[model samples]
Target chain A: MSRAALLVLADGRFPAGGHAHSGGAEPAVAEGRIRDADSLAAFCRGRLHTAGFTAAALVAAAPHGLDPLALDEAADARTPSPALRATARKLGRQMMRAARATWPGPDLDALARARPRGAHQPVVLGLTARSAGLGPEDAAHCVAYETVSGPATAVVRLLSLDPFHATAVLARLAPELDRVAEQAAEAARQQIDALPAASAPLLDITAEAHAAWPVRLFAS
Target chain B: MSVHARARLRAEPDGRGSTALPVLESAGPLALRRTRSPRPPYARVTVVGAMSAPLNGDRLAIEAEVAAGARLTVDAAAATVALPGPRPDADPSTYTVNLTVGEGAALHWLPEQLVSAHGSRLHQTTRVQLAATARLLLREEQILGRHGEPTGALTTRLTVHRAGRPLLDQQLTYGPDAPAGWDGPAVLAGHRAVGQLLLADPSFEDAPLPARLLGPTAALTPLAGPAVLVTAVAADARLLRGILDDAMRELLDGLKA
Candidate 1:
């Protein structure tokens, strides 16, 4: 497995439409649920286990040369929020574009052709990892980190919370991220149907509510 | 004990342009089916039950299909409350609903609350298939428990398909033990009552409903088919219902044919 490949996939700057979403932080912040780094850390932790874990399992499962279409359905079945689903497809499309340009493989090309509108982001991310010669653990780490990074990054802009503190929050979560990544990868090694179905209804609810907002920094 | 209801409505030409009525298919606990048209262009189907405790081994299945150019509305007369069965290790009550709407057909399935009693569980799955021009307004309202009671487990899944393509697929699992779902800022936010509404029609805009007026707790998501979705949660059921109604009105402009 290429360690550098992991870096490229995990980098928030890789441009997969991650910049536009708040990971449900905007609602939490709006509701005053995530006002500071402490609260933000709490929000990220909850998501990391629920949505984060679910996404990681999908991502981790993607590179095992499994069926992406079925994985896409699993991803859809796992996500209950329509806004989040839209965001996933939008980001999936963007990631597909970038992944095709970067890796240029049959796996990536086939998925892009099968889902012209785009597959789910986690499914695409995992396939991209396979193209990059990264393993399931790498895929899990990439998605698990993103589960928190996307929120931490958005919270900084939404609340004008100190960037340093937000960065610290991400740093403090590194250990938890590792644990979640391992758990997701382990789950992926099981039957695809038996993969983690962990969900956060509050996030699903808030994301649905946030999508209706006339003006918001994030698309979801 | 097990109980279930199934009904289907089809609209055909009435010698005018189009005024076909429903073709019904119902059985079992559904024997209590009642209908009264409040106005033209739509008829109402009220599903009710006798004083009942949906305990272990109880099953409720409702299947409704609307044929081409027809219109139908479904409403439940009362809440379906699930209680502990006569036996201690009773299985969860199962509520499975399947719906199909033909081209240019409209079906509104607005059911009442589904209350899960203490130490009981409810597993529900709703599957909907729509023709290219079908319009669907479906609402799934749920309360974890009665006022001042601990919430029970309800694992619900919804899947919608149009022209053989999957439009929306989602699963929601909530109870005391379902992991980081109920307590987070992203979900219930500590509130109890939750209402979900799905409206699919051409006039509906593919954007969030302008519903900040509804309350910060309420939200809307516009899907690719320009379908509209609203989910609101609060400790108060009335408030959640109000938010859902406002959202529906915003999407269909009073939901008139």
Candidate 2:
């Protein structure tokens, strides 16, 4: 099942340009909504239920041997924010680069060629998981976990939380991860052939506002 | 003043009851009071106004106003579910809401959720006018029916304009007679609750707190010019409400800062 490969893909330090992005932490920190560890934890939890749920559900539901381009388009539609779309594409590109180097496959190559403009991270992650022989449920877990962990880790770096404390925060999030992953898995099972839809207007507005800031730490 | 279907109920005198009270009352038309806050740079203000009318098959027209530099957010306590008339060949139930926001003012047009029951047909129209510098955070959510309950057909038309130019013009039609079309990717995607929040001429680049607090589910999208759109969609009403509350707090905080 290439557990090592999956870990590498999910690692925060995979050099997929995640380090430069706070997944909205930089802006939120500047705004003072997330000032400490407790606030950060609460914020991450909210994200997991909303955006994280949407992305993981889609990745988990992608049909076996599904076309990556179609998956990418669906992910793009689900993401209404242009700034977020750009960030997802950037992260996707870097992840694809890493995947091509670690586990080269014809399907991956086909998916890469199919996305001439850009690819979304969830789409690439799903393809990479399938290429590594991981099941849909596992793929969904990895996607959901990474989605939350990426921002949590970014908060640690941004807020200067002790590394140990950050780990603890991630540990506390384990139950939520399991719950959301189970929901994603069930959604995938129920609608394996269907596409994904997320129409969140407020999030898109914030993303748009964040992008125009002259100075910002996160890519999104 | 035009007369439509009208019915009034006065308090009945009870022999055993000590206090005299009016059980129910029906007015000539839906009584609507519009007030604007006397202040400058008012980001958003919300006012909820509703009246109970008899089930006397009348179409009510409501004119709501939000004065300049004053914001208003309106919503009913519950869905104004319309029922079929006594006669088989009766006119459908309809309600029209006219909204106006003055210059340099912001209005958040968020209404309570809507629920349509079986054999019910409703038509609603919302018209919004925004000033050049004024902003609007408007949203509407609708649920077809209660779980395991029958749902009737419903149609909604929305028109939004800024400086007399159309910003949004769309129509949504759904009902029992209509084909089950929510399962597709372009539609609800099997989601029971659907909501849309629109922010006009907002400072998109200035949302750091909400971006950080909301994390992944909440994102900001840059539109042409100075407008931005923030969105978050969830499976249930609770999650949706939470997201909306967080987003509003962040936005209000941003304005204060």
Candidate 3:
């Protein structure tokens, strides 16, 4: 497997349509809960351990020859908020398009045909990783990193905080991020039912609220 | 003392447009009492705890089934408080609940809040299965602590399946042993009470509710299926219940129409 492919896949500008969503950072900012780097770090940490861990597990399981459709169902099960589900599929479709262009394969083609509308982003990420000769751990790391990086980036734009400070927050989270990804990869080896179901109810609640915002910087 | 208990209840439709309970069994601390229903065609049953339950190492199970065309409502007399077991080091208690609704049946499972007191450890799982035409209204509330005290470790999982397809599955953890930052800005945000109301009705398939926020800390969203889920968090159980009760009224009114 080309290690460089991991960098390309994990790039923030991967054309995955993630830029449209704030990963719940927008709602927290509006509520005045995230005013600076410290609060943002706390928010990202809570997110990483809960929903982030769950997403990482899904991505990790996706590349191990697991059925994409079953993984899609599992993703839906883990996602209780309709708005988040819509956001995931939107990002998934965009990722699928980019992956098909970068590394086309029969597996990617079949899944794209099956979920013409879109699959969950993590499910597609796993498949995209597979098509690109990446493994489950690679997929897990990509998603785990994105889970916090997306929010950090959005908070920078929303709060007008220093980009360096945001980057520092992420750097500080590297250890926990690694831990979550490692655990997620291990959980992925178990039965689909045994996959982590950790949830952040506030994220689900705020995503629903964010979806209704007539004018917002982010889609979710 | 560690104990294993089970409660089984079944509601069937009578020929005269009413519901009848043909099976009702209670064992150990699970006391199932039949009660009067404010509305006709719906049987009401209240669960009363005969003893302190869900202590460490306790295994408790409650199973309820609503047959075709039947309507049943199950409620609890008081909140179920989780207390530490007698031994300082004891295994966490487990409570399992399974509910099923048949074709055209309706089940309203509205119980009191579950309080996880200090020094307690509990794991609870609730699963619901619904037929294509069934209607279900389920409410769940959790209070982290009694009052001004640190919460005990509590984990709860709720899974719902409609017509052989997953509708919702989520696991929530709280208290000392929970992951760090659980009470941070993006999660509970220092709220001691958390709850959700799930309403699954075929009528919603035609006119789904537009997703919106109920108040500052709550939101109502349409699910993938013909259902709506309302989630809220408040400073106390009373306030949490009030928020959910309001949402319940709104959703039930929408369902009736």
Among all candidates shown, the one with the greatest lDDT: 3
For residues A116-213, what per-residue lDDT tens digits would candidate 2 score against the true structure? Answer: 55588878777777777776777778877876676677777778877787778779988888887777767765532233232323334455567878
lDDT of 3 by residue, A57-168 (tens): 9999988778889889988888878889999999999999999999999988999999999999999999999889998888899998999999999999999999999999
Q: How much is the lDDT of residue B54 in candidate 2?
A: 17
Q: Judged by TM-score relative to the true structure, which candidate is superior, 1 or 3? A: 3
Model 3 DockQ reads 0.74
In order, the Cα lDDT scores of the candidates are: 0.77, 0.58, 0.91
The best candidate in terms of DockQ = 3
Model 1 stretches astray by more than 4 angstroms: A1-4, A11-21, A35-38, A57-102, A109-120, A135-141, A152-220, B1-31, B51-53, B202-213, B254-257
| Residues B1-257 of candidate 2: C-alpha lDDT, one tens digit per residue | 11253222222223342212232233353432233434323322232324442122456655545555554444343455555545545555666666666675556666666555566667766677766666777766656655656556666655665665545443445555432332222233344554555667545435422223245344444332334444544566666667666666656665667
| Residue B168, model 3: Cα distance from true site in angstroms | 0.4
DockQ sort, best first: 3, 1, 2
- Comparing 2 and 3 on TM-score, the stronger one: 3
| CAPRI quality of model 3 | medium
Supply the TM-score for candidate 3: 0.97
Question: How far in Å is the alpha carbon of B244 misplaced in model 3?
Answer: 0.7
- List the per-model TM-score of the A chain: 0.98, 0.89, 0.99
